[model samples]
Target: MKIVESHKTDVDNYIITHHYLRSAPAGARLRLWVKDNSDNVIGAMMWGRPTARTYDYNRILELTRLYLIDDTEHCAESKALGMARKYIRKHLPEIRGLISYSSTGEGHKGTVYLADGWFAVGVTRAAAWNKQGRKNIDKSQKIRWVRSV
Candidate 1:
């Protein structure tokens, strides 16, 4: 698995694949891609936004876009999340904590955020979206989680 601060171009394809890709709006994302021995991007994460237009900034590193394919790297999820936090604390110490949101409908979390010491801040009544034409996410009811870095 390789963790990288996205070079912009390297990530356009994957982000584009998500239907609501704009919600996580990629601006200045720190990314991690887990590649198989054949070097295919199986798991990925987009770590931050350049600006907080929708979600409020809380002096925390916004760890979003945690993605992993089935059994790609076994521990890719945990490793990717760790790299995300470590990278921020090491390189961007100005950020105070780590925060992220997940849908209850997202089924289950696989020890990535849990192992990193992230905890539930509160359950959001509705997940808000900043897009036009459409409202927020249908799975609007999500749980917010946070961890201090």
Candidate 2:
């Protein structure tokens, strides 16, 4: 397995095909892929400008999407993520920090980030979403994480 920079369209297709969210990242500035021996993509990740106003957008990149095919060997996701971080540092030298959040609604606990040496900054308060009579509790409490480059 190896990590390589990926095009946006390819990344979008991979994510749509494999990710549980079935959504493509918007405003993506960088995309990476982990390919198996035959070059079939096993994982995909995307980085983009922070959506919220919490950080210096110019110097901070947000990990908008990270999806890996299930049943792979251990540490594959974390290794791909680490390689992507190194790629970002080498290619986008101006970015001095990285940020990402995993949602409780998705049953994520930021384990990958934690394993990769990211600092856990606590979970954000929960907020529900309402739209046109639909009332769903947005239990996606984000567990925010950061890593200095």
lDDT (Cα) of model 2: 0.81
Candidate 2, residues 1-149: lDDT per residue as tens digits?
Answer: 77788765888888877777667667888888888878987888888898679688899999988888886769887787788778878999999999998888888887888888999987887766543443332446889899986
By lDDT, the best candidate is 2
Q: How does each model score on TM-score?
A: 0.73, 0.87
Predicted structure 1, TM vs. truth: 0.73
Q: Write out the backbone clash pairs for model 2.
A: none
List the RMSD of every prediction in angstroms: 3.7, 2.7
Give the TM-score (vs. native) of candidate 2: 0.87
| Candidate 1 residue-wise lDDT, 7-117, digit = tens | 654555575464243344555446656555676767566767423356545455576666666766556676667766777788877777777777666555435667767
Residue 71, candidate 2: Cα error in Å is 2.6
